[model samples]
Target: MTDGPATRYARAARTWAPIDWWKLEARAVYERPELRRALAPFAPVEAWRDLAKDVATAWGILLTLSHIAALTLPVLAGGMLLGWLFQRDDLAPVGLTGLLAGIGAVLAGIGLVTEAREPTGTDPRIGRLIGGLHLVPSTLGLLVATLAISLGSADAPLGVVAFIVDVGVGIAYFVLNRGPADSGSDRGRRNLARLERALGELPPTDRARMEADAREAIDVLELRDLVGADDAARAREQRLGLLAMEMAPRTDLATQRR
Candidate 1:
């Protein structure tokens, strides 16, 4: 049976499953002086950029929780204090309101964390739902706290300013936690481009063999329907081929020209 482009590519992709493409890309980056110079300004000095991504995700979750606590804790404590000090019959209402607001803030924080952790191919509707929940509840809780403070305090102007600042911070946090909507495939294509450029500078025969290997990888990745199939694979293969080619002695004098 003759394999179609998709099938062929799939088989090719399977051949290199054990290899670490990121590590390979890193090596390529180091080998090509020109690429190193070009990328030096933008690329960080960290061992792995993926580590930074993971850390950022962790920080997002932590920060969301922190914001929730910061916004709700004072209100809860104040409710308890008012109940103790005034012995007001309305203390029950005050405490209940504070407790509900705190709970909502917690839920919002969780939603934001979930949205941040969700993988690239997560359902768009689900993501939007989580993101909306994350934003809405926290906003509502902030508004409630602001109103309550304004009503209870003699310093109305100060209370109003505090409310505005609280709302502003919540809005900023929502914006900060908003995850990028691009698919994993888009990211992969960009990485492939960098790999390709690195491969292009290697010796000719090494470049050719790497090109072949990369084609196999692309076939497996089904990068064509994603399109740029051949080019992506060739670029990766050429980069890999350079290492293999370096170990073997060259036979062709004509190889020096191109």
Candidate 2:
């Protein structure tokens, strides 16, 4: 079974129908590997593991709330315009502008949702191509919104609609560069390097044996985290401890002979 923010969102959607897609998308960003990797460089090692988990669980809540406001403002503005037009018998002209703006908003939202679903695991060039294609609706919405705003009065309903689309564009731009953090494999490589360097000080036979064991261990191990106090961290610690234990017996025998 797939496990990730997207999957969780799907489950939630099934359980609780009619959720705000923008809010879901914002919340889901925390589950993306790219966001974790970006934050890793800045987070302290002592708290990194907990921090990553907590942030993933709660980071986007406020942004999602803000997304609701952004989404609502345009709808409210359009509704108010419709009410005023009803009072003046001018609903036809103003209603068409609102309709166009509404269509643009829907298109932009669909595009944003489509773009958000593209996996970060895809090849960079192919990902970019797919992302650009997915953004076509948003780009068109932006143009339509601009036109709608220009054709309407100073209190145009499309103003807030345009702003929402602008925010969607910004989100897409931000996510484009956010790819998964390769820190797990990177840290594994570093640990292996350190082990090999230490082994170089040992006698040829011991060095060869220890190096082979370490290589095999490194290749077989799976760690969700390379640092901090977590299960993956503990596993890595145990692996290193086992390596040290293997070295100790030979080192002691050598000292006795000396």
Candidate 3:
């Protein structure tokens, strides 16, 4: 929820001609004060910074589909597999009246995980205790759902429901996951292009000054020479480029803190 360099990039991306602004680096080299000051006349930097916190909270709460699916799909699929493997013809049709109670259980586990990690610290000890308590029911819900389906009690009910849930979860997963995965390198190039275009329209003097300031700032802030480029530290800053905002919420916690 804190307003750091990541927050600035995320918000600035939205205003910068609908590009995948999240591609902007959180490091000071990309978030240099001089570059920001140069662009401030074109943006509501303060207002966006204030909204950055809420936006980040919203992101953690709504993590697109990839992260959720990683944890949920396996459980749901395992439930279906168990149900199919153990189904009985003797089960009542009335039990088939509806078919989705099982789907809700997956939410229980992850929801508890979110609140514990939520950014609040008024009472650390109490928070930790309460957070752990949430897991009891979280585990219970999944356990019960698993048992019900696999034992044939919820098979008829969840027979088709499993497919629905998995497909829905699958489609959501794929759509959300569809984006550049590199550490914004590609996006960084695109952003650089956009910035270049903007600068192109400016007078030579102002453009020179702004570029000079940004270059100097990057020179000072850059750690490229300071640190070795191993080519495999492995960081991925998330989401589709142009269409990212359409499918996923802009307030991504993972990205906002990048």
Which candidate ranks first by lDDT, i.e. highest? 1
- Model 3 residue 67 distance off true place after TM-score fit, in angstroms: 1.9
Cα RMSD of predicted structure 2:
18.0
What TM-score would every model get versus the actual structure?
A: 0.30, 0.25, 0.29
Q: Give the TM-score ranking, best first.
A: 1, 3, 2
Q: Residue 49 CA error for candidate 1 (Å)?
A: 6.4
Off by over 4 Å in 3: 1-55, 64-69, 72-159, 175-213, 218-258
Leading candidate by TM-score: 1
lDDT of 3 by residue, 85-108 (tens): 356444432123223323332442
Quantify all predictions' global Cα lDDT against the true fold.
0.39, 0.36, 0.33
Instruction: Give the per-residue lDDT digits (tens) of candidate 1, residues 1-258.
Output: 323332344454433321234323333333344343322212323323421232345544655565455545534534443443355333223334445444444545554454344322223344344444434543554454454554563222233333233344345444543454222333223433553564566777644443454445444455434325553444444434232222221222112111
What value does the lDDT take at residue 235 in candidate 3? Answer: 16
- What are the C-alpha RMSDs, in order, of all predicted structures? 14.3, 18.0, 15.4
User: Candidate 2: TM-score?
Assistant: 0.25
Worst lDDT 10-window in candidate 1:
249-258
Native-referenced Cα lDDT, model 2: 0.36
The list of candidate 1 runs beyond 4 A from truth reads 1-15, 27-134, 153-163, 169-180, 183-233, 236-258
